[model samples]
Target: MPIQKVTRDEILQKALGVFKRQGYHRTTMDDLARACGLLKGSFYYYFDSKETLMKEVLWWVNRTSEQRIFSVAYQHELPPDERLGLFLDRLYAAVLVSEGGCIMGNTVLETAMITDEFKEPMLVFFTNWTNAVAHIYETAYPTAQALKLAQQLAAEIEGSLLLVKLGSPESLLRDCRERAINRLNVPMHDCTSNP
Candidate 1:
């Protein structure tokens, strides 16, 4: 019989789905090991503790998001509206519309208030997301206004995602995407000069 060797990325990818489905506290190391096709002790070989694995998972999600989703905002050739659409589409595919629905947000809600362990990596996920959206919005709005709008949009989208899981109409997200893109679709107004 041949022994199968699993890479860390392979484990993280599989474990991501489990964490997304079960969340941090509810998911046990055994569950993660099973998901990775390893025994519980074997799982320890990859991660010293469950929290350590989860912290790595959080950062892994952040890095994956930066590569697959947030990078859309920096495509200089694309117009703001198009870039925003691509960004939202990728986000929707990655987490928003997936069965688990926003792993980072879910973990933050489940873990942030009680334990600070997951805070740093999760902050990177959100901060990078906000910065990406702000970059897109900056195409049309002032820097401060862009950041404000990006923050507002992020809050709205995250809240709406929960509402979506609770049987709210999917249009809630459509409305969010449309409003964000619409805001960027317009020309930026200058308050300091010109009539």
Candidate 2:
């Protein structure tokens, strides 16, 4: 009998969970197959190799995150900082809590040493995201300055997410953000007002 199309989505979703937990280099095709309740041969039928599955999973993660952040950034009802904060909060919840970290960050950390192909997409995602952040900062700062600050903030946030995965307490991240918020001179009252 032909299996349902939903089964493939289920397998991919489960594979994503395993990949998120064990990371790209650490996870084997067997691991993903087991997580998806499929035999290794069956898994191979759906995905040619572990790398192919990983690339698709990482792309899904990036696409979902981009949509969420873009939704907040483009929404007219919310101010820039408020929208950014909402996005960040979603980020913290999505990547930081037990799932360990962002899939792009995880992919970069593990495969960056091994392959250029993996790093390319991660770079593009960061470039676009950092540009969006810079645009938001432009509401308060000069364009050039905002772009510089956005790069710095993007680096800081990515590093902080890595640290969170490494088991540093959340307060350390919050402290870093507080210091950054001060340095950016974004009014604190605005966060409370919009939230």
Find the candidate with the highest lDDT and give its number: 1
Candidate 2 lands at a TM-score of 0.82
Worst 10 residues of 1 by lDDT: 186-195
- Best candidate according to TM-score: 1
lDDT of 1 by residue, 35-115 (tens): 888888778889998898889988999888999999999999998899999999898888854477898889989998999
Candidate 2 residue 97 C-alpha distance from true site, Å: 4.3
Q: What is the TM-score of each candidate against the true structure?
A: 0.92, 0.82
Position 103, candidate 2: lDDT: 74
Candidate 2 least-lDDT 10 residues: 186-195
Please give the CA lDDT of all the candidate structures.
0.86, 0.71
Q: Write the per-residue lDDT of candidate 2 for residues 1-195, one digit (tens) a residue.
A: 333344766776677778778888789988887777677777778889887777777666667667876456566587765766775676677676557567777778788988986776688777777777777677767677777877887778878877776788778667655654454455544433321
